[model samples]
Target: MRLWLLLLLLFACPAYASEPAVDTLPPELVRLRDEGRLTVRALWAWKLVPAATATAAMELRAMGLDLIGADRAQLAAWVREAEEGTAAFSPAQREVLSGLLAMMDSGDAAASADMLPADAPAAAALPVPGVVDAVPAAPDTVDTAPPAPDVADAAPPLPDVAEAAPSVPGAASGPAMYRCGAARTGVSDASGPAGPPVELWKLKVGDGPCTPPVVLDGLACFGSVDGHLYAVDVATGALKWKFFAEDWVDQPPAMAGGTVFFGNVVGDRSGDRHFFALDAATGSEKWRFKSLYYGVNSSPAMVDGAICFGAGKHVYSADPQTGDAKWSLETSDTVGTPAVSDGTAFFAHANRLTAVELGADAEKWTFRAGANITTCPAVSDGLVVFGSDDFNIHAVDVQTGVEKWKFGTGLIHHPAAVHDGVVYAVSADNLHALDAATGTEKWKVNMQRAGLKAPVIDGDALILAAGNFLVSLDRASGQERWRFEAGGEITSPALAGGVAYFWSEDGHLYAVR
Candidate 1:
């Protein structure tokens, strides 16, 4: 035969002798290879899926997914044997081989590969990697002092911190969690001094403060990175009590019916599913409601004897006394603190604001935003105001889902503070006071940095954390009234009973008057 014809004749019908006609790999490996959501590149980037089979084997062993390992040559030989039908994998022993094949083929690696189960294994808590200590340098004008002893351990009776100011009419006597609830309106009947504020006392907590001073009765309750929820005396900064959790307590504590409700992040899952309830008078644990989802970062709202909070993808309503889930609303995305007004629960999440009926537990209306909205919505007078990452402050009519107006602003990570007819938005670069009815800018002040919390409306002054300072601005014209550098980036400040509280990144909580 001719050379070309001889070669063709030899190659034809010679390769199918031992090959399995259909995919005979284990079901799990097959499933993973075909159904994984992440791209191979993404898996490699997360270090969950390695680019090389040998590396993948090592990683799988380290993560405890695989025990019997193989070297690169052995791995190659196994693949070749399986391909040539010299060996076959059984279900019981397929995980390692299947994992390698699935990763090689860019298959679905299972969600567990991305996130560990909450109850899987408890890990040690170091300083919480990737989280920076928030202590900023103290301002040149202010007295830079060392942090006091841990407030939970050594807080002393502080002197009077309240300064004389006009009282806000009809201020509700409640803890200022999220500074007046998840709408983050930060509005309070408590008023601060007309002039510059003086630091009454500074109490050192652990690092990574979220929001603070949910003052109820005479105690100021707050959470810290030390994995403890602390209650300090409002007048004297004295340590009242502290409750420990599994991880960081970043959300402010909500209070109602003599109980305090708060959530904490367990491990890297944001927060575990448990929403904790404690006795407000004592630091004793009352009850904890386990939800269907984890990572409950939003502050809880007490509405009609029930506590409502956002966790993962659902907004949950539970009994405040028994810690039983009453109802939950499946939302489009992960939700924030819910604002309850006139039987309607307003939630800001993803790129829309959803209003669900508290009584019926049904979605009433949804106002779509141009971008994702992480901040909660402030609802009042049939109007809901919130800020979006889209760099706009939106005012939507609650009854109809119709957008009233959207005022252009910089990047806004926090909610808008709606008071009377004016809306205060702390954007990425400026503090803007807008007309709520028309979304028109009344005045804008250069705040120099975006506020992480809503501007706390303390009578005439707006207390906000801008840049590294806890700043008080004129609520009407957005004029700077006073500012105190907290020597760390501040989260949100809370105002109650004429005493303003600041939670800074430097692991210090300051009470200012």
Candidate 2:
């Protein structure tokens, strides 16, 4: 009887937010596909471009194009070679070729930032190096010479950067942690700003990439590498309060019922980890739990009365009120944050993505990938989506564990976001929008070395963190609407109440309107 009920629950449908249909490509872009081959060679030049440009000449050569002198004669010579009819170029093809040649002659750098490489470069994109570059450095070595400093007692004065946005009326209460609620689908409940975004203010926090802030009740909360979880006034960019975790706090805190749940890594290798429940009103510790693990970087997901998070190779569900262990499930390797839907909790580790029946202590099913899975699973519309070091974005059945479909990408080190029926995925330098049902490519654009965060859906724009820029693109056509450059690599960003909040690796928190 229980099995039958479980099966019914797995296949049940849930309410989904309304989203528009994917946009068709521009006429010029449509012409690039001729008989299954992309004749726009420059569009695929990304395969040959180096990860970072060193010299203009090297960049051109790396993209499989010649670096010619900036002269009309030189450009004409190259044009003539292509115009002489090698592949029976169509008018559209010829125009694209001319554009490529012109860009090459003029040393256009944006060309290399877009597109995938074919031939030799495509093969280079497939290798899984022994050391995965997207994985951030673990807090391995601890300075044993002196003890760590204490938590901040008084609110630090906000540093001068940009003017803060005017205080807006926020929720009567606080914002729920993670993705607004326990679902963790990466969808923001707060409406995004309309049209091009503008920077409102920036405040320097402790060093290290700041975890995506959890906004609620006019306060934005996040932890920093300098061992502090900070609460900042969202409207004025003022520091509200800070709690020091004696160790590094890389994961965002989960808030529920006016309490915050978070964890920190231990410096020593003894593998002693700690989880704490703090009063949302006061930064005072409410309860603390110690686990025999090295760290807990996974953001906690609150379901039922328990808060679930992953530490090392285990997933622990603890009572949100008392921080007592409810149960623990061991995975093959270290686990990412778990996303809950229906009665299942989804997590990824090593090369396997597994689903556990919450509170039942039973396995639902597991799907294996070709390589390590680093990002958390985003669940919506009866499907789960995640990216892998295997250079593929996978979508799978939420119930039967069937392989629905997969899309090949360069290296998907971040999570994929799904809304309405579209999946937004990032690889190396490209952002792809795929049909959520069949994994068909709807449209794609280059993001110039994209960062490791799931794209946030705001009104009509899909916000992305790309290297040092916070970029907003048209959800339908992948067109750039606006960009805000930062001092360092930007991590994940959060959107709420017409404002987008994010942090950079340079230890600064920014609010853009």
Candidate 3:
């Protein structure tokens, strides 16, 4: 068969003098070939037609080749072609294409140029004024230069460290700590030069317990069961402004961008609960959203321009400025307050703890705990720590959503507080300290009654709120340093500010010195 085919070819071929020179192709064709626009035949090539088509559109756009002019119909067609071509591109190329499409849609072509690869020849060919030039390029080669001298190495002139003014006594090392919850559970460790000492300026706003006062810009804002949210002067406890809601507001207000956001519980009615954003300075309503659930006990969390909170069995992300719904994530159980870090949101539900990616309503993982979770999950150092109704403290890996370790306490309602590589949790009858890395119990101190709230760590002390008394213990030894009895039963942890603030179940807010 081979011999026959060779004979046939020899007879069929015309007597050509010589082969044509490959370089004789037109300059335009040569340029296209150089830019990888030409295709070659291969035995098993998988042609990504969609990606190729998208690339063709993008390259044309990048080169400022306006094939569709300014006609709306032509532009639509061009965008459709580009969209179809996007499926063929690599993931990185697809991301660039998506960003460019977004910029074009927003009428910011100049901004789209910055998303172009620095090495892209098209970027150099087509310069975008102002916007694109600011993009920094990744270095392709490392520079080997002699190390610069350290600032400390040059002892040119010394500012006498010993002559410097002695540090102020009783001054905080950083910013004044801010706490959340009626018990003031969320306090920052930052302390600096002592501002005025934080005094408990009590105001009789209502008959019921007020939500934890949120301090922002010298104003302390809180909501009461009386259906009113009030902003009081932190210095004098004077009323600045107040806003009324349709129902009870139990959650702490979250302040962001000069606005305060909070949720309300439905009162004897059957419609959506209200979530509102108010002007920080005036206490006027900026925007309000109706949650499609019975009540929203969870406090709103603000990040970027979105407000996040849970109602019923769903967690929602709403625009803080416009009160528009960006996305909603449905959960198996009611969600608690959500804490965000590193583009991920951590939330607790009645039976599970869920971690979801921000900006995209996708679940990273759901950890099922055998009991209900009432407290918010705290995350730090790549670990998530929370307490369950099953009387256990669980620590899980943040990245893989896998359980690292769990310590059972055999009592419900213990809240977990994490600080300095230690998890402090309280059972109804004891305070337990566990290693944050391994969940091993460092020490356990028995109390006479249940501790419904977590211990607050301040400096070297661990403060515990046990039913009717406040106990401060040494952090390292768990030895009781001091104990104070209040007039009524105390269920929430106390806030530390030189002095401490706590609420009694009988509905009185107290400041203990």
Candidate 4:
């Protein structure tokens, strides 16, 4: 993205609240697309061009260069070239930019505080040019650090600087712990946000993507690519504490008895990766199990006092409090986040859904799919359901790991939601409701470009996001109820105390109510 467009987007509202349908693209945009100049980034910026120019003008004005109407018109031309896009700007707009460039050539520039903030804590549409470039590609080695300083959970608005850097309810009164973490029950009873949510607060932790947060013990904790697990006050969004992982902490943490357990990704480094248990209140290290070969992105499932998660080529069951290994089962690849039920850990990887008796580390059975499984299995009603790249939804018997039923559909990515014996599978173009006992379709609604994260069941509504709209659908009828427009494409949502918590690539963890 061009530097100007980035600044403009940061200042202006989204171009469109919902994904633009094919019929809606303006003529100029369609023409650019035909000319091969309208890239995804260019299209997005063009959509916002109507509102983007004002911000750039304000910043330029502060630098003592007055921008006229012609200059502003030429701005679009400058934007495309800034990113090396082929789109042409109006001649009227181009002339203005030429003059502005000439003036800038004389070093007549002023540092615009609004363009980048002082903290350098939040990220932009993309990583800032030098921000990630500044960090060493790989750290030397792993270091175990205890309780770190508290970050203000409720900090100021997303800092100007571009750089910084879901879970099972059945298992109770918390948001989804990881992406489809509540797969076993596939339901949450918490009533998320009563109305169109207003941004209550945001915490600028790092200049990278954050994992879906696990809200536990009055604190919202999640890992970040910055190699830290951050715990913030749920009510105030104040950073209570943070623990450094010395590598990317890419998954959500599992919290039990005031201790938060989570995993990280071992990048291009020789040092072994570590899965850690940290003090929830103070961010102190309790214990950590070091990985032998792979880094862990699978969020651990806590059941029967065992933390079961897949890392490297194995799924291990360890004591959550002590990080002592009880059992480890070798797997074919890095496994999906495990769902727990009846003392069994259910997860997917390499086109197979496997069940293992926890504690004993005994294999129960494995159900192989026709294609690679794209998500964790949603277990319910004695059946475990999941989607695959085979363009099918498969439900297997929990006891036998045998295919109970399969429903064909477009490629599925997000984990399905099962509530009241019904599997709610949100696929690329359809939100399907199927009978959990059989593969019978109960109801189906067109989602049309749904998000990749699993939907959250808030009371009787399925909260889903497509494009920039966070939509609520009646769970039973599959009828749309409401749509909340966010600043960016919404990801996963977690609810607690009527507040819906979700994050987007826009660089902030949003708590809305």
Each candidate structure's TM-score, on Cα atoms with residue i matched to residue i, is 0.66, 0.66, 0.59, 0.66
What RMSD, rounded to one decimal, does every model reach? 15.4, 22.4, 27.0, 15.7
Count of backbone collisions in candidate 4: 23
Candidate 4 lDDT over residue span 299-391, tens digit each:
888766577888776888888768888888887765767888887888786677789877564678988877667677777778888887677
Instruction: Encode model 3's per-residue lDDT on 412-506: one tens digit a residue.
Output: 44347777788888766778888999999999888877534566676777766776777777878898877767655554443433555555544
Backbone clash pairs in model 2 (N, Cα, C under 3 Å; residues 3+ apart or in different chains), count: 4
How many pairs collide in each candidate, listed in order? 12, 4, 10, 23
TM-score between model 4 and native = 0.66
Worst 10 residues of 4 by lDDT: 159-168
Residues 1-513, candidate 2: write the lDDT tens digits: 999976676567332333543222222223333223222222222222232211222112212232322233443554675477432222433444455444333333344334222222332233332443221122322222111222321324542212323233322254366755556666777866566677677766654446778877777788864566777777767665667677657678887777778887543122246888876655668898875545675788887778898877788888877888888888767667789887689988767889998776767899998766757788899898887656688899999778899999865656777888999888778889999999999998876564535688876778878888888888889999888888787766887888888887655678888
lDDT of each: 0.61, 0.64, 0.55, 0.61
How far out, in Å, is residue 120 in model 2? 40
Candidate 1 local lDDT, 1-513, one digit each (tens): 598876776578566444654543224333434553222222222233322222223222211122222323344565676466554322223444545444444333343243322222211211222323221111121122234566443565422212212122123355446658644566776665556777787677553334556776766777754456777766766655666665546567787666779876432112345689877666678888665443565778886777888876788888877988888888766677788877678887777789888756578888887766746788876798887756678888989889989988755666778888898887657778888788888888776564345677877778887767877777767677787777776766767656677777665677877
Q: In candidate 1, which residue ranges exceed 4 Å CA deviation?
A: 1-175, 181-184, 266-272, 450-452
- Model 2: per-residue Cα lDDT at residue 389: 56
TM-score of 1: 0.66
